[model samples]
Target: MAFSSGDSGGSMADINVTPLIDVLLVLLIIFIVTAPAMTMRVPIDLPQKSVNPPPPSNDPPPPIRLRVDANGQVFVNNNPVATRQVEANLLNLLPPAMQDGQAVEPADQPTLELDIDRDASYETLTTVLAAAKNIGMEKVAFLDNM
Candidate 1:
C-alpha cells in the first residue's frame, strides 16, 4: 500500500510574483524621479489689509470720459482732443474741488471712463493709461457698449 501511494499522477505548479514586484518598483522609482521635474513654482505677493476707514464724501462726484476711436483719435468728455494733449487736458480738467490745500475733505476724484474702439491699437490704449496715471486719476474704468 505504501508503495502504491507514490503512483499518484497529478503535477502541481505555482506562479512566481518576483517579476511583477520588480516592474512595480521600477515604475514607482520612475514616478518619484519625474514628479518634481513635472511641477512648476510661481511667486506672488499678497496685499495687507488696512484698518482705517476712508473719509466720507459731502458732494456728488464728477465724471470724466476719454474715448478712443478706431482711427486712434482721443476725446475728453465728448470733446475731441489730440493724443499729445491728453495729459495736459486731464491735469487741467481736474475738478476744482479736488485741488490740494483744501480742508481734510473726502477725495473729489472724478470717475474716469475710457471708451476704446474695438480696432484701436495697444499703443493708443497704453498711452491713454499712462496719461491717466500721470494726471493722478486713480479711479479709471473702461466703458463697454451693451
Candidate 2:
C-alpha cells in the first residue's frame, strides 16, 4: 500500500488488489475441489424394469346397481328401498367383512353404479348421493341410459 507523504498534495488513487486476487483464487480452488465431490454418484437401488406384463388377477366382484325412477323411487339392485333407508340398503350390499366395521380397502369395496332416470328430480338425486356419501362409498359410477 502506498500512502501520500502530504507533500504530493493529492490522495492516492491506486487500489491494493493483491489480497483480493489471492482470496478469489482460493475460493475458485475450493469450488473446484467440492464440485467433483458433489457429483459423486449415490448408489440408489431402483426397481428393475420387467419386460413381461403382470398376470391379470380374477375379475372383481360385480358392482352394486342403484336405480332411481322419475317418481323419486330409489332401488338397490332392483329392490325397492325408501329414500330414508337408502344408506342401510347400500351398506347391506357390501361384503360380510365390510359390514363388521372393519377397515376395508378401496379395491375391496363394492362399486355403486347409479342409473338415474332423466326425469328424476334434483332433490332425489342429491338425496341418494348424500346417502351414498354418508355410507363412505368411495366408488360411485353414473350409468348413462342414452
Candidate 3:
C-alpha cells in the first residue's frame, strides 16, 4: 500500500525510459551486425567503371592465305598473280590502319598465313616473305598443310 501527502494525491506521471532506451540500443546493434549478411556480398572489388576494355574476344578475324606452288606461281587467295605484283597485292589486302608506316598493336591487325607448297622453291618463299615484311606485316605464320 502507498500513500501521498500532497494536497491532491495522484499516481506517478513521469514514465521511466531507462528500459526503453536499453531495448532500442540493443535492436540497433543487432541490425548493424546483420545488415552486411543480408546484403549477401562476397569480398571482391567490382569496377566502378570500365577500367580496361573487355578482354579480347575468343574468336579472331579470318586470316589471309598466301599460297606458293612448286611451279613458283604466286597465288593470292587462290588467284594467281605475278611475283612483282605480290607486294602490291598483299598491301591491298591490308586494312587501312596498317599502311601508315607506324607500329600497330598485334591484336588490332589481321594475320597472314603462308601456305607454301611442300615442293615450292625456297626462293619463292623468301620473295613473298620479303614483300610482306617490307610493308610492316608482322603477324605472318606458316600453314602446315597445302
lDDT of 1 at 10: 46
What TM-score would every model get versus the actual structure? Answer: 0.56, 0.57, 0.57
* TM-score of candidate 2 against the unseen true structure: 0.57
At residue 137, give the lDDT of candidate 1: 68
Instruction: Give every collision pair in model 2.
Output: none
TM match of model 3 to true structure: 0.57
**lDDT per prediction?**
0.75, 0.82, 0.80
Off by over 4 Å in 1: 1-56, 97-106
Clashing pairs in 3: none
Backbone clash pairs for candidate 1 read: none
Each candidate structure's count of clashing pairs: 0, 0, 0
Compose the digit string of candidate 3's lDDT tens values, residues 1-146. Answer: 34556888686566678889999999999999999899996443333565775566466556788988889999898889998889999888876767667776656667889988899898888889889878887678888992
Give the runs in model 3 whose Cα sits over 4 Å from its true position: 1-60
Residue-wise lDDT of candidate 2 within 1-146, one digit each (tens)? 76887786787999999999999999999999999999999453344677975554365557999999999999898999999889888888887777787776656677889999999999888888888777777668899999
Candidate 1 residue-wise lDDT, 2-104, digit = tens: 1233557644455667889999999999999999988966432333565985664677477788899989999998999989888888877777644442332
